[model samples]
Target: MHKEQEKVTDKNRFKSCMMKPDEEGNIYCPQGHAFTLEQRKESVKGRYPRTIQFYRNEHCEGCPLRSQCTRSKHGRTLQRTDKLAEMQIEIRENLMTETGQELMKQRSI
Candidate 1:
């Protein structure tokens, strides 16, 4: 039996599994399609109140990677909460500090 070897390099390595939105608030799929904000919902009744934002890519109908990306006919969608976004920003800032860098290096994930 023969098996194919995986090709991984620095150019293709990703630090996080999730694709982050750009500074301008553009969310891109794994295939590089730009997703637009579709809706904003608030969950005031929930135990953890937060604002949810929805993003969708209209051009996914003809995308070759559609089947792999999603099973729904709605193409690809990304949902993020306002609190999560704020936390992400704060985490990024902390990760840039010396203490955060040392913490990252010490962790054994």
Candidate 2:
């Protein structure tokens, strides 16, 4: 007999798994659409002082995937800091490992 495994049905999974960031701070969507850095906003002084950068994809204006990607009238916008994006990618990669899965299993119990 075979046991059934739990399926992940989170909708936001596409957002996290589709976006890829390059070394130059440029992010690319699943369709190979590149989003360039549009603006950098400074953050207030706090425990984590990091500047947030906003990216915009001009090609999203008439793209068929616009509806699925974003609802903005202007274009698709993405926000992230270089350091934060790197950290998040690292954390996500770690969470996919065997050790991480074991740790997560323990947390559920």
Question: What's the TM-score of every candidate structure?
Answer: 0.65, 0.67
Misplaced by over 4 Å in model 2 are: 1-17, 23-25, 89-101
Model 1 C-alpha lDDT per residue in residues 1-109, reported as the tens digit of each score: 0011224343332212255778897877767779888999988765777788888888888887677667778777778886876786698789789998898878846
Model 2: residue 35 alpha-carbon error in angstroms: 0.7
Residue pairs that clash (backbone atoms under 3 angstroms), model 1: none
Full-model lDDT for every candidate: 0.69, 0.70
Task: For candidate 2, write residues 41-69 as lDDT tens digits.
Answer: 98866687788888888888778777777
